[model samples]
Target: METLKIIKIGGKIINDTVALQQFIEDLSKLKGLKILVHGGGNLASETSKQLGIKIEKVDGRRLTDQKTLDVVTMVYAGKLNKTIVAALQAKGCNSLGLTGADGNLIQSYKRPVTSIDYGFVGDIIQVNTSLIEILLKEEIVPVFCALTHDKQGQLLNTNADTIASELAVALASSFSVELYYCFEKKGVLSDMTNDNSVIETLDLEAYHTLFQQGKIADGMLPKLDNCFNALNNKVFKVCIGNPKMIVDSNSIYTTLQL
Candidate 1:
């Protein structure tokens, strides 16, 4: 079995171009990792705000209106995506930039509208891993943006965490892979404020307790959900931590246990 790793870099880290460049340098030295999924939410939101577009959030998830979606696509798929790809290439890593629209890599359905329409928001329906396999066979890392196409042929913005989870499940089923959800946090902390008290492992029961205690709120909620989802789908392992910690196994990071 070939070893593969699907890493999802958080938007906050992507916004810091220096961090992204360093991350690429670290990744280039890894021999067998096949793909990377990147988020551009922070950049997208910032760009949208500068362009006079209001960003709406529903339950901690971005509510992508038409204008917001356009901005997101431009940032996630256009600027940030290419920048990462270029950075990796300069570091001697063969890389390709893509979105769900390319090769119809990800298929999605529009989110149902209620009080306020999530104009161009989507829920991922499927991922075509064939294209990814081809890229991996040639030792090219596929850098994906969290944008998908709806059933009606319109591009819709999807959650980057969701994209990473779905891609992890797909790749794990097809090959041996480790999925890492890298973010700004050191790890999932037992006490939200203390980085030293990071929870090294979480099982389903512990996750439920944390959620019930309201400790898991805001962004961490969806990230935790994605972690469990990947575990349920039988990915080899899932880790949540800062990007720098991912390169050091001795460094503490939250590990999801089945």
Candidate 2:
């Protein structure tokens, strides 16, 4: 099986031009099939605030109201998506920016109101793996944004981590997938305040201990879940680290194993 590298980049890197550019440059050098998924919540929230759309979250997941949906759709699918594609293009990577709506690549259902009505927020139901296979076979790098559709003409605000994990899981049968989650922190930290406090190797037991001790919370909580889910579903490798770790073999980063 050929190797596939699925990279999910978020946090400060999404908004910081220098970091994003550096990431694309590194991405251009990666071998075999590659995919890029991005999160631009910081930028989305800023844009929403400027537009007077109230932003809300429940347990690190966004509560996407109608107004917030419009903001995120425009920000995630439009601005951030194209920006990534264009950057990769300049770096000599043939990148194709896509949302779940594009070619029905991902199908999801909206969250039903339970304790919270997450508005247009979606939980992925299916991924069209054949389309991805076609793209990768054609040597077209797919750049995905955090947006999905119901196949009913409604765009939903989906989580980028979820998208990346689902894609990795789906592609596992045909490819040796390496799932990379690049974020602001170098890796899972032993101390939150210390940026250099990287926990290089993390397994489920250690993760549970830290999690129960409340070492991990907020966005990281679900993000870690996604990482484990991918590993369990046969993703060949899962790494959480700074952007440069994607290119640097000896770089300090968190390596997750079951």
Candidate 3:
């Protein structure tokens, strides 16, 4: 099987033009099949504030009420996806910007009401692996935004990290899938205050320990969850780190192993 890399990038990197450009250049150097998934949470929040929409979150997952959902759709599926695709095109990597609604790439339903209602947030149900494979065979990179839809015509906000993980798991049988969660930090940090405190390797036990101790909280929580899910489901490898890890073999990064 050929190797496939699914990279998820978010946080400040998505909003920083220079950093995004650098990431695109690095990603262009990576050989073999690859997919890019991104989140524009910061930009979405900023846009929301500008439009006077209240932002709400519980444990790093946004509560996508109707108006907020509209903003995220525009910022995520519109601006960020196209910008990344245009950059890849400039680098000579033919790319297509997509949402879950596009080509029925992903199908999800609105999260059910539980302890707290998540409104229009989505829980992914399916990934169209055959569609992905066809794009890969055609040498077109798929750039995904954190937006999914119900087949009934409702768009829902989804987490990019989970999207990347699920895509890796879905395609694992056909390829040696490597899932990557890249952001501003070098890697998962032992000390949130210290940028240099990267844990080079993390397994399930260590993740549980840190999570219990509250060392890993907020946004990093869901990301780590997706990492383990990918590993447990047959993904060949999973890494959480700076985007440079894509191009640099020895870059400081956290490797996740089951």
Clash totals for all candidate models:
0, 0, 0
Q: How close to the true structure is residue 48 of candidate 2, measured as C-alpha lDDT?
A: 94
TM-score leaderboard ranking: 2, 3, 1
lDDT of 3 by residue, 72-103 (tens): 99999888889899999999989899999999
Cα lDDT tens digits for candidate 2, 47-146: 9999988888786667888899899888888889998898898888998999999999999999889988888988899999898889889899999999
Models sorted by lDDT, best on top: 3, 2, 1
Of 1 and 3, the candidate ahead on TM-score is: 3
Q: Give the per-residue Cα lDDT of candidate 3 at 7.
A: 92
TM-scores, one per candidate: 0.95, 0.96, 0.96
Worst 10 residues of 3 by lDDT: 55-64
For model 3, name the residue pairs that clash.
Answer: none
Could you tell me the lDDT of residue 160 within candidate 1?
A: 83
Error of 1 at 30 (Å): 1.6
Clash list (residue pairs), candidate 2: none
Per-model C-alpha RMSD = 1.5, 1.2, 1.3
In TM-score terms, candidate 2 sits at 0.96
- Identify the runs in model 2 with alpha carbons over 4 angstroms from their true place: none
